[model samples]
Target chain A: MLDRIRIVLIGTSHPGNIGAAARAMKTMGLSQLAVVAPRCDPRDGEAFARSSGAEDILEAMQQFETLEAAVTDCTLVVGASARSRTLPWPLCSPRELSASLPGELSGSDTGLALVFGREDVGLSNSELQRCHRHVHIPTSEHYSSLNLAAAVQVLAYECRQAWLTTTPVTSPEPFGVEWDNPLASHADTERLFEHLERTLINIGFHDPDNPRQLMARLRRLLLRSRMDSMELNILRGILTRIERHGDPNGNDHPR
Target chain B: MLDRIRIVLIGTSHPGNIGAAARAMKTMGLSQLAVVAPRCDPRDGEAFARSSGAEDILEAMQQFETLEAAVTDCTLVVGASARSRTLPWPLCSPRELSASLPGELSGSDTGLALVFGREDVGLSNSELQRCHRHVHIPTSEHYSSLNLAAAVQVLAYECRQAWLTTTPVTSPEPFGVEWDNPLASHADTERLFEHLERTLINIGFHDPDNPRQLMARLRRLLLRSRMDSMELNILRGILTRIERHGDPNGNDHPR
Candidate 1:
């Protein structure tokens, strides 16, 4: 899904930004780069310096005279806009774009274009109209101006996350991750809760008669935490110490 | 949550990157920064210039001689990495990191450290082991190198998003932040599972030959939610009760 996606930079004012954007794309598992009517040379010294060893991406980047020509093969063109216009486009957050990307990338020949405009001014009204959707990165109202490269990084990162969900990687396990250790089983968790209830009662910390919201809050806390085996052991060790010595700070002297 | 998160850069080579990182942090509403034995002076002209009007953060930055000194008050230390080392730490993507961050932050006094290593070598093995968790920003296998400022920006953005959750969030959750609680450390969670599988097999609930989907489902359930210390104690107590009684339904009776 990531491979089918193309990153388009339209009339970028600075070559350094192009390089930085390329670097950002590479860091987020993106390679296909296209430049439509770029103002500066992407292979210049500033670009090379800014790329930080992602010259390969800049070298292989496709250059076209027009945005339409660049995204001619793309079925879905998502323009990145910094502002809301008089006529609103299908604007959503970067995360929303990621969620809907898989469905759009389903077609074999379907290409998805993530078009970024010039550093000074974003996509033109006509340019944005040619696109299928628009994504706005939420920032503080005080300083909402995000750097072109930073914006690219955010969007690229989102695409990679979304791609991980859609396609299974050949190298790593599903979602490119599989835990080396197992999580605490449901049965064990239930037992831990009982042990906790007992320990609390013994230590005069909790009253079973008027349990109140203690157990519920604890359940919410533990259930949310998803304790692993070792954490359970550590907590159990502490609890056992408390039960034996009735000392809350008996954690330092372990058996 | 964002205020409690400290961005620690250890032995950074470039002063400019530090300034840029500070800029990124300021943009994302993060201020706490700790530099452990940096190669270049953060107060240098380059750092100030790179900060881009975020000199207040740079001016208020904390300096330390060692990683230990920097994170003395922190309970949960998470390292960011770009490479896969011989010793694989508890690795997760940035999105996952952001989701689990809020619960950990609920303990008002507990501090969480987001440690970034040297530009070239990253966090050392010992440094990583000292850390409770690790996060890897998913990058392209071909060119996975990430700029220090860019890396900081991504994490700061995530932390800002996570922080938004604990406080009354002004904006809707991007990617739907379903945080129940903070996750247990890898070591602790492992012990709970080992103890669980042993007890279940002992009590005739599981056969080692045909483990079935019981454990898998349990894992999904546990990992889906976060658990806290008291919750772990409660669950462990219940497990102990079952171990003693050799009865899956012996949860009601006290030991």
Candidate 2:
């Protein structure tokens, strides 16, 4: 799903930002980058310097003289906007754009282009009109403009996050992740609670007649803790120890 | 709510990255900036130049000697981690951290600190342990380390997105939530851990000599639970009772 989405930079002025943008995209697992009518050479020294370890992405970048040529193969073109209220095109947040990607580019061959405008002026009215939709990153009203590379980072991050939901990396296991022992079952938890309540009363820490939400609060905490079988056994062992210590007989038989 | 969130950079080596981070935060409506023992002067020319128009945030940046000092007042401290599977700390996604902000910072006095470590080395194990939770930004497994500014941009952007869409919940209080008590502060939680360690040792449930990841497992469980002050107090009371009852004299003492 991430591979189907290409990052398109339109009329990008700074060569360094282009490299930085590539680095940003690569960090989020994006490979395809397209430049439309860049003002400067995209492969300048500063571009390589800013590309960090992502020089391969910069080397493979596709360049075109016009937006039409750049995204001619794309089935969905969403222009990145600065949240302009006057635009007639349907505007979506970066999250919304990410959410719509799996469906919009459902086919393996279908390509989607996310077009970012120049740092100073952004996309021209004609360029904006050509997009299928506009995706806007919400920014502070006081300082609305975001650096080109930073904007790309946010969008690419969102796309990666959304894409992760579509694929099954590892089957979702019960919580208590990587525990050596199995997570305590519901019945085990209930039995532990009963034993805990009895021990608490035996130790005079809890009063049954006026419980006053003590057991309820303990239940809430322990349930949220999500203990595994080992941790549960440890707690139960501790409770038994306290019960024996408090008992006058110090025997197996309960009073 | 955004105002309560502070971005703390630890041992940052570059002035330019500092400036870029400020710009990233300000673009997302986050103004608070704190630095722990930065390697370079944060107010250098490169920092100011890279800050773009977010110079005010850079100008007002707070300097600290250590991570503890940087986040002393914050009730919640979340670290940006590179998704190391061996870590015992509770790990959350950026969106999960953002979604939790409203509920975690429900009180007016509550504050949150998002800590980013040294650009090259990332957070030390000790520094990572200080955080109540660790937030990992999903990136390509091949090139997981994000540029410090890019990581800040991604996290800050999610915070802004979550803030914009948040509506106060009119629904009844959810289970495990205590309305009256604020979430336990970092200091409070630390004290609880100290007390817990001592109590476990006193009860012979744990041995300090051969500590086999016992405390780490317990820490992971309790931190995931996210105890409020009242619940924390209740647990402390229970510990004190057990300690006293186990003593032969039933004296007012920890031992």
Candidate 3:
């Protein structure tokens, strides 16, 4: 699992940050680093000084011309971003992201790319949209500025923890604790959400005419819980049961 | 709750670390700083340079000869340490520490003091014992060395999160410089310092070329101490009286 994780830094402004980031990644046993259009030389003196003996990682760094180029080969691409956009994307806490990783990396040669943005503005719109998910590091609301390397260190630390432990059948069980089954995948979860939303509208529970933020909020809630295959099946069965009574043409005679 | 969080630096060898720590604390709305037997002058140019805009915190800093004295009034003293001693004290990860804070600071006249030790070796065994709890920020196991300022920033960030969510019951007025008055703004504080430096110089108490960093250090100390408007007026009044006594023509009373 460790070998499958890639750290991608995009449009990094400082050479020192690249060096520090390399050091941060290496400390957690992560060696794969891809730099996309960095503003400074990765092997500069400041970078070496900040690496504090982890210069080997910097020496082996791979350079890319664009964010798309960096994560093109990875199956799972995650953006480390704190910003929210007009259209909501799937978001994961570091723990949740960690818990999901072992399951994703279990059988495939496919890799996971953890992408960080420039020190200032973070990932561009298209870059963030390219990610499979976004991870937010909880910090103070007023003083939310975390150093770039520190952010990498935190996410890498979480990945290391998850790599050392078994993936819970449901998301976020106690560390080192295992379950009998694996959680449903993102694709499966989205299908379940669509099924649930359609059933809710059929039953007159959710009004499409004045649809506020119901489905989006449900997506947020269920995605955080991370249901297993059994949980998903049970939920879908209930939705199917309710579907028989609430179809547009099912009412024989209106009372 | 912000007022109740006190930051203590014990035997800190560099003045720059103190300034950086002050800046970190102020960004998260914490103001109290206590320095215990620091080896370097707290008023040095390095401190001012690193403090950024948080010199108010440095100005208000309290000096102590011993760790015990520094935390005498604190109901809960927590030490930020990376190394463990022969016997383990009650230890908390940073997340656990954040979860426990809201319960501790609410409805209490007492305060909590977070103590950080020397840059190289962490707190002495006795000093660690002085704390009610020990918090360790989870970092890379291989290269777990975090800068002093960064550690402080991480902890302060957590405290700020806790503060924003909790209900306000009481203000931490007793610990501040003056009761029943809010702290003077940075602009007001700067004016007060100007008033002070001019008076001290006019009284011939401060030499021009050999002035050393007395004024600069004093700015750091008083700013961090967070004196209120009333306290500012009282301090200026004292300086006014001292100037009258030190005037060159005041000693000609036929003696």
* lDDT (C-alpha, whole model) for all candidates: 0.75, 0.85, 0.72
Q: Tens digit of lDDT per residue, candidate 2, span A1-255?
A: 888889999988999999899999999999999999899999999999999989989988999989999898899999998957474789898888888877887886799999999999999899999999998899998998699999999999988987888888664344312435667999999999999999877667888999999999989889977778877887788788777655557664343
- TM-score attained by chain A of model 1: 0.72
Clashing pairs for model 2 are none
Which portions of model 1 show Cα errors greater than 4 Å?
A169-255, B164-255
Positional deviation of A68 in candidate 1, in angstroms?
A: 2.5
**Local accuracy of candidate 1 as per-residue lDDT tens digits, B117-236:** 999999886677556556898787777788888999898888877765566443322214533444454445445667766766664456789965455544434433434445555566
- DockQ of every predicted complex: 0.19, 0.51, 0.03
The deviation in Å at residue A216 for candidate 1 is 18
lDDT at B203 for candidate 1? 46
The CAPRI-style docking tier of model 3 reads incorrect
Off by over 4 Å in 3: A1-4, A26-31, A93-111, A157-255, B14-31, B41-63, B157-255
Q: lDDT of model 3 at residue A149? A: 76
lDDT of 3 by residue, A13-73 (tens): 8888888788778767788999999988877899888787787788888999987677666
